[model samples]
Target: MEEGAKHVVTGGGPQSGHCRSVSLICRPLGMKPHVVIEGVEKREDLGSMGNTLLYRMAGSKLYLAPQENYESFKRRVRKMKQYVSDTYGEKCYCIPVGGATGKAVFAFISLFDELLQQGLHDRFDDIVVTVATGGTSLGLAVANYLTGSKLGVHAVTIALRKEEIYENMDKLLKELGIDSVKSADILDIIEGYVGERYGTATEEVLSFVTEVSSSTGILLDPYYTGKGTMGMVGELVNNPSRFKGKRILFIHTGGIFGLFNGEMDRVINKEKAVTNDITPWLDENVSPVSIEQ
Candidate 1:
């Protein structure tokens, strides 16, 4: 929920079987909220999907800000570097990879900016490693082209539906006038560890999240950190020779709240019933019978 983002609700007037409504909370960069209102007559009810008010706000497209993501990424990178150096007594480097969910793209861009400021641009490079996802990958591609970083960006995507990644990346690059983005087979780097489902949490990821929390008391969100960590671990385990003892920093983008919902609580309670140890005492207090030794 960024600033100036308005939550607009549009629905039926407490009646009608076709209660189809759509609400859009759009906050464009610096513009104020522009509301577009529309009304439909009762005679226009075509079907379940068509009888609705289509509200479209004009001038709401310019409020896109990447600064928030950049700031968050900077903070996480600083913390991670500090943690690694303090714990391992060694300096490490972080690379921005994966899709843009959980502000991955913004963080990657912000990391590049910070590196430029710290004069570490020459020491580290940025690579766009696709994870069979779309949003973050496209975001990374767009940001890379926009920032004009000289680091090598290799778009490594999984073999599953990789053509889509290639197509989207090319379209984005072409739109941005960036003609040098390269695509590579991520299998060599990532090592086909993706399981049956597209975005389902892997056992390795679940175990990693559990172990990390148990050891450090830091919870990693299932979607971004868990999956991203699984990918990193797969890379490390299968392609250890590639890293060659080099420090690998996995950016834990914060999204822990995603794991919680009303249904999740119900599921957890169902699995492990909560018990209240209550002892009922009579109004006339029957004193505890002390075992006199």
Candidate 2:
């Protein structure tokens, strides 16, 4: 398995308090399992938790969590952090991009809680991280600040225009009661990988997607996975020193649905066309009887 890539295992059901459970077994080139997690799930219950409470606390905002369980948001974050640390290692951090799902926030807070439990309070030394343009980035920044960890979060983004991402991230941090949250330019880290449009597939990303599927039989969502994998690869290529000969983990926040619909249809159509073009000889082999007109 390559460094800074998500590896997922099949054959597991959803776990309580978690959206789903999948095993991540990471064994560096010549080393033992450097990182291993037994169960990881996206909390689907977040949507039904109610928006009224969220609106009351943070005002009627489209992105903030709903009012009902909005307060439990802190507890959820702690849970996620504990899950990662218990299964993986204390150094493990849940890296997720801010998107429509709103699960990353839960995951970030969970990590913070785990850190506190582990009593590793002053270990905030140049930890590498990744965030995207959305609530996930904001939540992560907030969690990092709460833990007082020095982070180098790569804000991976395709949607939310650059200026908008900056402003939104700032607003989110302030709202979450996190004052000092530093960030790095995601585009600068992934300049040529974004392709033509937001959520659109690029040649490099598609190739990487195909490679992962063929080699490891792991599927990646087109929009986020494709972009995120591209970002991770670019980071490894450019800043080899940060992770050279060291074990690094890339959090694979699930989003298989993003690969379906329009983009998947296009990919299917293209593949069918190629298959048809290559199998022209099969058409000649099948002889047909002539019918009288």
Candidate 3:
């Protein structure tokens, strides 16, 4: 578990969402994650979330990654973490976004297994999945690989470079013992809706998420689900007939806690808090009428 892991925290970004969930679950089992952060201060929520997780869940505090762009921030964090790990001789397993190939593949297989068992698999013409680290997307791509392209398992790039993403998917299949499905075979990458960069959600993006939440009671975190859903909706809305016989099923991997970050909180709810103008502070009004201390 220590080879790919470090004490450092990286939950602020969308790709880091999966990492956060994994760390939280594994922390109680004596795995204390600690590392230094450097330049990753693009959004208020990223900082707030990192610190909040450290305070409530672990014995250590969060370190800010250096203030570089998303890619550079990741690089700096990785280098610092390696330095610490090598110095202290700590081991961490660095699984990719969907817990590597086997897990990712099985996740989709299991999902579709149940759906197919329930007589629900034949209803969809397409399955829209998110490709953050190419974990789950690659898995579903495997499923599509098995289906011989009957079920359109298209992945939308929410973060990272699309080229590397497809490559990762190809590698994941190879790791999963599926030798035939190449990148070009099982890859259908949709781009242009990442909202600037990782962990950064645009105003329009938040609006759609809020609307979806209000209407369906299915909350979507901004980074992963929000971006993927927005992309799917935009495509379907703009070109209805393109998928006329197609039933689009958008898969939402759970990451609700990521929504509590500062950036998300800012746009999630604009309604004022319920209050009676109740005095929240002690009477500093005793300007001249104060008793001797």
Candidate 4:
């Protein structure tokens, strides 16, 4: 976050929004971005899709790490940071995966406070969001507790298990100098939403995504918002008595570009549109006039 820093290094999966965001914000700050990607061994293997394409377009230097090797990923990021320091004589600001650091939680806390200020707490009974790294949901829960709001915070887990999500939130809570409160007590982490694993989409969810986009004009990516929305819908259908009259606020975290990461196009359109001829529509009565400036 230091203005004097010349480079920012971060790590995430190929379709990670955090990587794309870091790379994007670095450009205007005159800071070069180095993104370490998981699930691949080289750049060639990291195809130009979704956030990966955005990272390249933002001019970020890319590094590859093994999919499941956490130690190797950390080492790769560290090396990239050190390499930037050695070559450019400047310290590189490193952001963890999903930007899910302790300090990052404060942002969502601030957001919650803003919502309270706008009196959104009175409008909605529950707050629903997709839990990727648990930072946003944790922050919201913390804010809810701190502000004494009764609104329920429900986080639909996309990738990690509920235990893992709790662990991440607990670590963040400790970082904020709070140990008395547990994350599980504050957050309602819902399960059974992650279909076909992370980054993989199901046909049903894809259909829902298209329907939501077409009807509401609010695009939801298959990875994050789409799944979260589907989960929210499922919750309503499965337990109508619980939320019969309660209004729910479903947070649409920005990942519209993620729709391009997979087979969303296939769901939106079964086949490509045929090219049309406009020659017949042209009026013969009006002569084409060319005005040269």
Candidate 5:
């Protein structure tokens, strides 16, 4: 369906599962392609659960560029992969940040238009998205610019500093060919959720994860969704009157890490295996759901 999708390139950062997910698309999504993965962050944990799956499925065609971070990876892998991207002649399939800005923003605009037509757009006062590499958050920023949508777009930054995230968003906006737009009028990035270093979750983060999953039945991986939700919930609860009777849409940046060292992680992983054992509870009384105002 996509040209130049045959070769997948990614920053195999240990912090997020995005690159790992990108690897899966190479085989099943289309033709058999060569994958060049750049392992930017080299921790003792070595690789992620995603890296493991990518290695297993990609086979011999997969080329790995393992290094400490950006500079090292670029030096080791980037220069050699010039022929990988048909469009850029340098980049791989997924750019995660600037590469996806234009595409992501335009896609969200289509969704926003549909919501407007259905009269569903009036409900939300603010929109929050999980920000790691800035693609998703910056995407909504561009959508706001193009549509002139009144709904506020906020980012719950997961890893980077606020200044860095904002700077990246501005750079991405320019790269998306939508320059000279004022970010203050369109986007707000909140940086109250970094907790510790990337992939290092504190006790509070795990607690929040357990509470939300138990309450909403939403599986939030530690890296993105869990931290993102924690940031949103904290704001709403602390300043109740500010968002009272207002609907704020929190975007769940989905992943499949199955978070570690928490009760939710154990249950999330174990429940599938023991589902037959809980057959009696399966038919328990449950009411049908309806759209909430």
Candidate 6:
């Protein structure tokens, strides 16, 4: 964006992290953020919850539109941009759905550079990350190709098909003036983890997420990280030889807020025993401290 840009626009599903991030970033920069939500018809149904609540808290303007197609959504965003300019007399920068543009890929490239700086570039044999619009994984793949590292980038597809992600990667490659290399050659797209489509999770998967959070203290949302974890674990369980001696790093992108979006009730164990017993902690070596004022 230019120095004095007044408004920004982006589009995605209701719980899109990218849209929420844009709102957060824009607010701190004195720029107003506008989000064009997909498949939403009424404002009331959008509801103040999940990423939607975060967007509102950041003072983002919401525009609901139908998910007819990608091109149609783009057209609607263009119209929104025009409206912002005409109505407010200021330029509005529009971000594509998922921020899956060529420029956005560089953000992950920088992230990969940070990993190299932290001496983690060669510590892992495989990197597992969740993929929706594919920008993040493409950036990592570009970094891997540039650095000549041998680590594999496994992108678990939670929404789009493999071909769709590949297409997005190819477009990004063109933006970087690269040729003679195909996206599939550098990126591994993992599928079959999207249980009931995007933003939907089965009870088994949710239970797995609960178990993981309880054990590791890392909360994995059903939308992305949970599915990515399942895909990685499935690979290791089904084909142990592939990761027998290799160290795998699963990228835990933060989507914890989605867990509070009111779907966890289906996975809660109502019959599980709850206890507040502290007798086990009281031993002969244990003592309490006394303070005097």
Please report the candidate that would top TM-score against the real structure.
Answer: 6
- In candidate 3, stretches whose alpha carbon ends up further than 4 angstroms from where it belongs are 1-15, 35-46, 50-56, 60-63, 67-85, 97-103, 240-244, 264-293
- Overlapping backbone residue pairs in candidate 6 total 0
Best prediction by lDDT? 6
Clashes of each: 5, 15, 23, 0, 0, 0
Which 10-residue window of candidate 1 scores lowest in summed lDDT? 12-21
Tens digits of per-residue lDDT for model 5 on 1-293? 44544455544444346555555565676534444454433334344354455544555144555534434543444543455565444434434422245566666667656656766567777778887767677767666657666677777777778776677667667767766785545677777788865555665777677667677788787767888888888877885453424688887767645363233444434433321133323334755332220
Q: What overall lDDT, based on C-alpha atoms, would model 4 receive against the true structure? A: 0.81
Q: Write model 6 residue lDDT over 157-271, tens digit each, in one string.
A: 9888898789878988998888868899898888889887776788877887888977778899888888889988988888656542478888888888778777777867334
- Candidate 4 segments whose C-alpha is farther than 4 A from its true place: 1-3, 69-80, 240-245, 271-293
Residue 83 shift from truth in candidate 4, angstroms: 4.4
Q: For model 3, how does the per-residue alpha-carbon lDDT over 170-261 read when each residue is reduced to its tens digit? A: 66666777786586566677788887776668878877777888778998877788889888888787865544256777888776665676
CA deviation > 4 Å runs, candidate 1: 1-111, 118-160, 185-193, 202-204, 262-293
TM-score versus the correct structure, for each prediction: 0.45, 0.47, 0.73, 0.85, 0.71, 0.87
| lDDT by residue (tens digit), candidate 4, 259-292 | 8876776665454312111233246687644332
Q: After superposition, how far is residue 194 of candidate 6 from its true place, in Å?
A: 1.7
Q: Is candidate 1 or candidate 2 better by lDDT?
A: 2
Tens-place lDDT per residue, model 1, 200-252, is: 34545555666666567877644345555556666656655554244433434
In candidate 4, which residue pairs get closer than 3 Å at backbone N, Cα or C atoms, i.e. clash? Answer: none
How do all the candidates rank in terms of TM-score, highest first?
A: 6, 4, 3, 5, 2, 1
TM-score between candidate 2 and the true structure: 0.47
What is the alpha-carbon lDDT for the whole of candidate 1?
A: 0.38
- Pick by lDDT: 1 or 3, better one: 3
Off by over 4 Å in 6: 240-245, 273-293
